[model samples]
Target chain A: MPPGTALDIRDLTVRYGDTTAVDGLDLQLRTGETVALLGPNGAGKSTVVNAVLGLVPSTGTVRVLGRTPAAAVRAGCVGAMLQHGGLPGESRVREVVELVRRSCPRSWPLDDLVVTAGIDGLLGRPVDALSGGQRQRVLLALALAGEPPLLLLDEPTSAMDVEGRRAFWTTMRRLADRGTTVVFATHHLEEADAVADRVVVVAGGQVVADGTAAQVKAGIAGRTVTFTADEDWRFAGLPGVTAADRQGERISLTTDNVEATLLALLAGGRRLPDLQVRGASLEEAVLSLTSRSRTPIGADR
Target chain B: MSTLFAFQLRRVGRNRQFLFFTVLLPALFTIFFTQVFGAQAGAAAQYQAYATASMVSMMAYGALGAALGATIRISFDRASGWLRQLRVTPVATSSVVAVDVLVGMLLTLPSLVVVALVGRLVNGVELPLSTWAGLVAVLWLGSGAFVALGLLVGHSLEDKAAGGAIGILGVVLAALGGLWVPVQLFPESLRALAHTLPSYWYAELGREVVAGDGPALLTVLAVAGFAAAFAVLTAVVLRRRPLHAVAG
Candidate 1:
């Protein structure tokens, strides 16, 4: 409820018939903060976001800035880029932006936002004619039309390619820098790692972990070490190393203690080539945590 | 509600495709049907009544389609996550549905006028002052019913295709309800089936009014009741399903 906190969700739960889509999830975002919600498919990340927007019903409490989602929307406190391209077919990119601007009492200039979102070249194109990445940009432009204090995005870059995704991340960071509180939900851990100042990993309708990206990585408690050796590395007896394998010249090790393993390897007089120790990439962290907690997304890896 | 209403109306108006389907197509059909049936005297008389009634029904039916179109819009929006984006925005959640209904109404008005005019000019149908008033009343009642029906259809269908299927069915109901020909011409069993339909009730009321007869007050009551019932049914369904994706 404090000023600049675009969203405050507490113990939120949402159910559809017998299925509980979101269970006791808590989330918060303040101005200039870019928060990423990371989870595999079926995680309640989207449910929580929808509940905060008032598009879906939820039990518990959700306040946007000091008001409920509906109230906040009327007060111009939130902006969103949902899965559906906010731009309708038959509508030009410029027209959609202008329309949203009209709905918003305080609106940004269409030309300026068009350029900022890198949609200057797409202004005259009908929404349906644009490529997926272009449509994504237009959706962002629509959401940002009012220059709302809070922004909610559900897979903002899911349809974009590598370059497009990277560009969108930069745009998102810029928005946060300009005082927009952003909460984005995505299945791609790498995207979350690249853009999210804070990451919340949701699974089985619950917040399994919530903190900075480093904290989430640390919570998983393992590092990946890949090195090349003459033969397969005998990692069966290594302490703190949970798993290890060799692929051709590459030796991969999963260890709970990276420093200790490195020291032990060095002491063994084993001259390893191309040895690299990584605490955990967002992808590794999510997979390990989800695998330990629930159904192993054996496929995601 | 006002701002949301205004915003939705404008947004829908900008959808050239939906606007064409909701208004332009129906008016063109009204003109075409009136011309096609202009020759036969009895058929002309029947057509006149049918055209008037169908025009009203068409508004309700098309309004229903447009309303469901909003559902399609929502489903697609959510599918890719646009609805989620809007949720974080300052737009009121209720505005989504509110705007859809208002857009349906805007699209409904022009079609109603086109049908009335075509019926009078091409079909030589003239009505008394009370009949004119009754047409207005029936259009409102029928429009309300279909609007609610559209909401229910939109909320209940998981696939956008199914939502569209419901819209086409609205047009089919027109033929079965005697919107193209008098229900009197149908087989006894067919007539009985049509009589039980809300579409039939709407057409019968339009026919009665066009004959310079004031429809029984009960007719108005029944139409209004159907509208309220459908609206409640739709709201309840929507509450349960919320944003489930419709068949694309």
Candidate 2:
């Protein structure tokens, strides 16, 4: 309950019937920080966001700007763009934004909000007539109409085209620069890496890793070296190599020291064709961590 | 709240089907019923009585249709996630419900006017200005019960089913409540059964006003009671099954 904390969730658990969606999750976000909740499908990322927004029932405490989620929402302290559902299709874009603006006691200037959401050209169109990306921009405008300090977006750019997505991020970056705290849930690792100052990876209803984008990627030990060679069990026992797999003529090795592993491969005097070396991507880091946590030691042998 | 109300009013106005149901259908029914029934009554007084009754019935039907139309729109909005979006804003749930009912009542006005006009011009029905004012007032107030009924149906059923159900219910209620035929013409037992319905009291309010007698206190109480009961039922259902899209 600090002044600078934009969101505070402690031991939050959400259950639907017998199934637990989010299990004892805890998270905190500071003012002006842009964080990404990164996870695969059904990893409880949406549940956590819903719990914070009070859209879903939860057992533990969730506070936005030192108040309950509902209170914060009513006070115009929080705004969100859910992954699904949107404005009523019959109304024009400007009308919908005006409706949302009327709900709050204080709101951003109408023209400013329209410009920030990039919806100036879309104001006259009906909601159902617009394409998916255009509708999303209208929803964003509605969310930002109140000029809330904390914004929560659930897969906000999922429907946008490449250019649209890029433009959306540019707007988001501007908002963040103006000291708005943003927490968005997305499975797009590249998006998280590009936009988030911090990333929280959830898997199996738990936070598997939480750190800066580069730090999380660095958690996975080394680079991968793939080459076409005769299938050899000796590669698995080579120095600095953690694991090795072969698919027909192609061999892939996970090595802690890429330089030493390369030297050893060349010293063997075997023909190595189609060699490819790459560092671990954010996706790989998350996959490796989640899979490792699910598998017990000695079971992988 | 005023802005939201205006937005809802605009939405209802733009819907073609709603306008047809609220104005055209009721006006046509008024003309047809007045022509068919107005001749059967032999005396001039009898003709006045028949035309007045027909006018009230058609107006009630129109108001009921408008109320149901509003309910269906609300259900569609809930299913489409618009309600969820509103819930996150500073607007309260009660504000939305109030606006919906207000819009429904406002939409019913055209239907009432159309039916009254047909009764006056085509059927030669006549009443003092005060009587007309009283009838319009009671009829408008009586619409609250049907609005609540619409809400109950909307919250309980899916969009398609709710529309069909309301349509059927409207017809059944209109027949049983003595809107189609005067309750006095029915057998003693049938008349007794009709009197128990809120629609009977609503029609009675219209009949009493047209007869130059003020609305009966018991009828007013009965209509108000029905309105209160329907409102309670809608509130309970909405609380138990908060509006959301049904997952497939």
Candidate 3:
């Protein structure tokens, strides 16, 4: 275990009765890096998170900041937002946060915690009275109360609307900028591609791909070409373009060959000012990688 | 564990709706049953005896209901996912269960104490200090059976079903144990059935302690056996179907 390492897991396996939920998974995360565990439902993402928290029994080594998972959790160096039972009802939001704060000896200042989670206004509200988004903000505040060096979140924004998710990720980006090691599990490819510095695609209890978003998408669906065109102008006739998506004046053409697609757009004397080309969308890359894993999920279960 | 205990106290203790059911209802029952039943006892000493016995019976009833009835909250906690959430924290699962059991037993006190005050002030049933303490202790300790039943119900059944089961159990235990209505008033066959119930022995122990009999051997064994049986049954239910919703 090095000082820069946030988490190190080797040969991790979790079983419930005869069913194996996580099978020999290995993952390592570095300090000050925000990583996403991207996968579809039942890909062992929740089981992996539970194993790291020491809430689920597993056979392997999971070192959190150079300590066992339970020790690190008790030391208040690791924080998590799990899918099940993250908050208790009947208490005000402040009480729940205060309860966690009391257990954390190296906690951050109360003011910083409330501000970072964007829950300063929600402190006076009862936990039950809060909307889903407000509750998430409070849960995030509780997760950060320990000033943990590492944070783990499981499907954090699943209950939130688009605007609530935007607010949540804004707070997350700031935490990443401030050098907190964040490991979040999300099934949304767009979220992983946009928010995370690196994405680990998991499926069938194994890592199918682990790299930067672009690297994961490198060999998948060619590239996406974007240019300013009228919504009515269809790019379907363009060479090598598999799909053309029109968004008002912005047209995105998904093509297997960027050069052939670009040549066709320019052949008709099109003056495209917002021209840009990038690796294929994360959605394609995940579909290909997750399906290519050794076992499809249903067979084992 | 202490912090969780304090939180649990606030949750069950401060809720007005539950307080009415477990505490106030039993106290009212004590006054009503004493007045209604004591009207026919011609002798003053006999009427006083009836009042004292009625008060003790209600006290046992209240404590039993409080201990057993509060387990519905555990079902709700399981449904709400609070149980699972707490498991991942520094607090151990056994500590949480201990806290719930401790809180449930603590709640049993209000009913016993309230019924005692009603007996002394309203019904003029006086007893020595030691005798009063002994009766309360007998009933309170006997509540262990109800606590075990509550835990079993809370961990084994679903949320909506657990509440109904606890309610039906309270009524049946009271009826069979001769708490709500005296077994003396029942037919010969019904009276024989009462003798077989743990509730019957549970209430008998309290009566014997109040009579300064030091809990007759048979009564003590019966109550202890029933408590042990319920505890063992609870363990078996939990092992077979772990509160998986709450158990990580």
Candidate 4:
């Protein structure tokens, strides 16, 4: 019904011994969409990535590019950059790049891969000698060497600096625009908001919220009402207010029904002083969404 | 597979530690043992006899480094998550192990050849060209057991512990296998214990070749058995707990 489904994961569950990591999660992505699996630590982000790569045993139906993860991998359609792994030591960057490239059923030219990853200058250097940020770029190049249609990166920018992160995401955007479906896992709210076409917020191994960044930020509280409330102002008991934070002369209230809360505040001859109302920022929305995990607050899928 | 082998060979070639143990140290041992333990030139026939056997032992010792070298690389790769990363590629997991095994065997050749050269030139151990060639061939072929053992050790232990474990194992194997000390000098009970070790069979194969005899059928079978057994154990262990570098 849509442009080929890049990824379709249904009821995916992963367990290690007595502990369950991912529980009944469903996710679908379209070709060329830049998606982020946004979550805090231990939110099953890596497990989901591992499942998509067929690296861990799990109960799930995960199809990448219309094939099983392993089959897609064999077909050279899925390339992944794991969060933590040391590249083979005693190897030059060029050798590592060529090694992964050769293993792919479909590969780009070495020059093209290096240029795309911006690691051409580091090719002949030993991998062990590269700095952390430099190594991440080299690994990114290695992942792209196969010309895979689906690019999965787990915390790709973790080792990068601010400038490196900005540069890395730019390359990702360029690649996505050219038809590669990019899926990355990160906890950085701003990254999800700025870089992802769709943000899937996960907490406690379940999809807590999933939508465009704007929609996810508006899913739970919808908006925040902030004003400088002096003492003796009891805002916590206001109508439709789910959360209230007070700091000195500033008070911020997150409300599902901003209109109702505003009306009630101005009722009884009380003035809504220094009033401010705005949609929640991605950070506020995510914090509220994750903390209310017991409720399973639904967002547009 | 060839690409993997070639890539791995380059990596192994650059590992200074592997090169030292596989080639340099063994060459040094050949000269050290032959001169200190064996007869010099113009010595008695019994002296020359002892020297040739010691030279074969050193050659066997050198070949042993191949397995140790292979073990270190495999374990390090496992611990570092390199193997896990390769799993996501199109390459089959079994192919990586096969490549590692092949690399391990290839690495042994340098040690075997260098040790034999040192034995001939520096130690003045005399042997026909054919005999020297045969000794190298037999020992090279025999090193598969060590490589298999290395693979098992790699799978069984983490990288940090693997190095020490294999080093001790190599020394113990050399001592009991009569590579470091002649089994003839061991008491009757200790020599019986040496018979059970694959390294003993590996060295005996070389001694048999240098003694102007075909490698003993039992010795060949023992070496092959060790390779097969260690390979099976490695497979079983890997299937149970793969080289998963990081837990989720």
Candidate 5:
């Protein structure tokens, strides 16, 4: 483990009976970095977060700020918002926050936490009376009560509406800007794209792709080009074009090099009309990468 | 830990089910049993003895019910994922359990006082101040075993099942422990069976304290042994089934 690293997980494996939830996963995060763990359902994203929080028993080691996960928790250096956990329904919102604050050695002021969570109106309401989105905010307040240096959130916005999601990310951005190491696991591709500085894509309990958002997108096959042209069999033979299809006057081509394909199309004085270029979206990139047979594409470390 | 205990206490204070079992029912039983038996006993001294015994029995019932009701509360917390949420914090599991036990004991106090007051004011039963203190102390400490039993049951069963199980266990234990009727009124064979239960020892302790004599050494040892055994069983259950297993 390197000094100053916010989280270091090495060869972590979690199993349930004969099924493996997380298999030999290794990941590290530096201080002040916001990383997203992205995967489809049953892809072990929540498992990794649970392992980091020491909530599940797993083989191998996990360290937060150069200490074991349990040690960091004891020092009040880690906070987590689990995917499906709920607050005490009988307790009022503020009282629940106060109860959590008492467990930490250092905690944010209750007023500040209430404001950050945007739960001022919910302070006096019983937890059971709150809506799903409101309850999530209360849980968020409890997670922030410790004011920990490391925050691990597993699908924190799954229960939120559009407005709630936007407000939640705004709070997260502020926390990350204040030098808190934030690692969140989310299946929402757009959420990871919008909020994460770096993205780690996991499939079948392994890190399939790891890099900045643009880098992970770029690591996928390539772009696509479409143009209006006469039906011809020769377009498929163009350089950098992997596949080509012609239907009437429209031609679509998938290419590894968009520049080279365009150059080839125009080099022959081919009058291509209505030409368009489209880059692969993050969703497409994830699908293509995970669908492969354990292909470690662009897993550059 | 104090905050957790205080929060739990406040929740219990508002819980209608807890109030019904721990306070209202016990007070009603104390009043009803004393009225019926005290009027029929004829002799003033015998009437006083019956009223005291009824008060003690009702107090024991109330304390045991509160301790077992704690299992229902814990089961709800576990089902709702609150217990698993707490596990992620810096609070130790043992500290949480300690707070639970403390809250259970606190819930018993109101019922104890109410029953004792009923015995004194309504039934004209009187005891020395020291005896009152000693009886309360014994009942309070003896409740630790039931608290441990609550924890064990909470961890072992699901939410609704746990509540039903604790309720049934409370009634059965009360019947066999001679808290509902005097042990002397039972047949020899039933009395022998009652002597084998931990509840009997607790009831005997209360009787001895009310009779102006200290609890026997064997009774005290037996109660302590029950507490230790239940505590160990709780620990074993917790190990076999971790809190996160119930997480949503």
Candidate 6:
């Protein structure tokens, strides 16, 4: 757990016109952990973040640090980086930071926060002049301006390049280590996998899967083994192994029963060599979880 | 809240376009209209009175533009997710709205000065010291009324194009109210109809002050009544359906 209870949403329902954007969705973010909210477009991820910030009207219970989102804000408990470039176009970055500082009782220095978010050089520039990634970095800086114990990031790195994103991931880890709870929402599964301590897959406006990286992957039902053998790999032909790929001396096997695969490998009739057992990546686990819940990619399952 | 109000005032000052429309442009319009109409307008005492009153009322309407620009900018804030960012800050949401209202009021002062200068110098309008005091009161009342109106429009229409529509509406109301031209010059029947408009009430307030009658205590009461009504009505609409109702 991180230092703060990042956010707690229970039975939150949001309606826009006649359509329900979020229906009875429940989520919780623990202290010192980065929880990645993964969902397709219109899956209520942003809505959940908005509800936690009290930006929109909604029905249901939401608590950030044991108080309503607005109350929590007044108490200096939470901070956020919402969608793309959430800043006034004409405002200078320093001016924007100062404005945020006025709203928050506790805040970091404008220069330090800017540097932390990798936008120190952009302080004098108008928001409209910044590149998309630079603008995002500035917005992220503003979110960190208040030194909030809990932070909500809705697609914080969506505009960043690979290197910028990697830098941001280091920043996130540092914040988490200092006990700030983080709830990050993004559509990019690989980024989520690389950075988030826990991955929560959301679909149909509900949380479909929630667990640590390895725990989530383990939930998808198989251990994969890849090896190169002097002779043909003995475990390749084992029952309960659903997939076997062989190319020259290399063999890859996916097994439904890990115990059976390991025992067969130990039998050694084909002299198994250089064997390695691998768990599924978080991306694969998320795909499998979402696929089993609905459709994998194109069609609904 | 005062801190946020100060910050918002700073933010509004950075908007060059808002300053142009609400301050510079209105002052220029007063000067230009008075120059074009001055000779014929000065011929009749009542026309001179009408011209001066119109100039004064235009000040109040310019104040309305300040409110309108602030309101629309707040709507933009909502759309850009700045409002959301504010919500998660230590500042209260009421502070955010309060800052805008306060900034609108602060910006209105310079605009009123520009209109007064145009009326006295460009239109050759004169007023007693007491009349100046009354003018301030009437302008404040008119401004309060229009700020409320701006709030209602901004709350109801959150789109950028809708802001233009409301800006046009503000200008039309001012024209009908005699901010650009006196309603007295219009036909009697039309003047009678104009009297029913809120802008006319504002214009009338200025006319009475400059003409030395001053607004009777009862008339002042009536202006207060109008301001209160607008404020109450706008507050109700805002309470019922906030601009970012869909955001959550």
- The global C-alpha lDDT for each of the candidates, from Candidate 1 onward, is 0.68, 0.82, 0.80, 0.83, 0.83, 0.72
Per-residue error at A40 for model 4, in Å?
1.1
User: Fraction of native contacts in model 4?
Assistant: 0.61
After superposition, candidate 6 runs with Cα above 4 Å error: A1-6, A15-23, A221-301, B24-38, B41-51, B217-233, B236-248
Pairs of colliding residues, candidate 5: none
Off by over 4 Å in 2: A220-301, B181-197, B245-248
Task: Please list the residue runs of candidate 4 whose C-alpha ends up more than 4 Å from where it truly belongs after superposition.
Answer: A1-3, A220-301, B40-43, B122-131, B245-248
lDDT of 5 by residue, B1-248 (tens): 88888888888777887788788898899989888777899888888888999999988888888888865788888888898888888888888888887887777777777887877887787999898889888888888878888888887888879989998989988998899998899999999989887788887888889988789899999888988998898888767676665221
Q: A149-204 in candidate 3: lDDT tens per residue?
A: 89999899988999989988988898899899999999887898889998887766
Q: If both were scored by TM-score, which would come out higher, candidate 3 or candidate 6?
A: 3
lDDT of 5 by residue, A230-294 (tens): 64658767887755657778887777689998998899687879999997544444554654445
> Which is superior by DockQ, 5 or 6?
5
Clash counts for all predictions: 24, 0, 0, 0, 0, 6
Tell me the DockQ of each model, to 2 decimals.
0.30, 0.39, 0.35, 0.50, 0.36, 0.32
Indicate the docking level reached by candidate 6: acceptable
lDDT of 3 at B208: 90
Worst 10 residues of 3 chain A by lDDT: A292-301
Report the error of model 2 at residue A177, Å: 0.3
lDDT-better candidate, 2 vs 5: 5
Off by over 4 Å in 1: A1-6, A15-23, A27-30, A84-86, A187-190, A201-221, A224-254, A258-284, A287-301, B1-88, B133-137, B158-160, B244-248
Model 1 RMSD in Å is 6.7
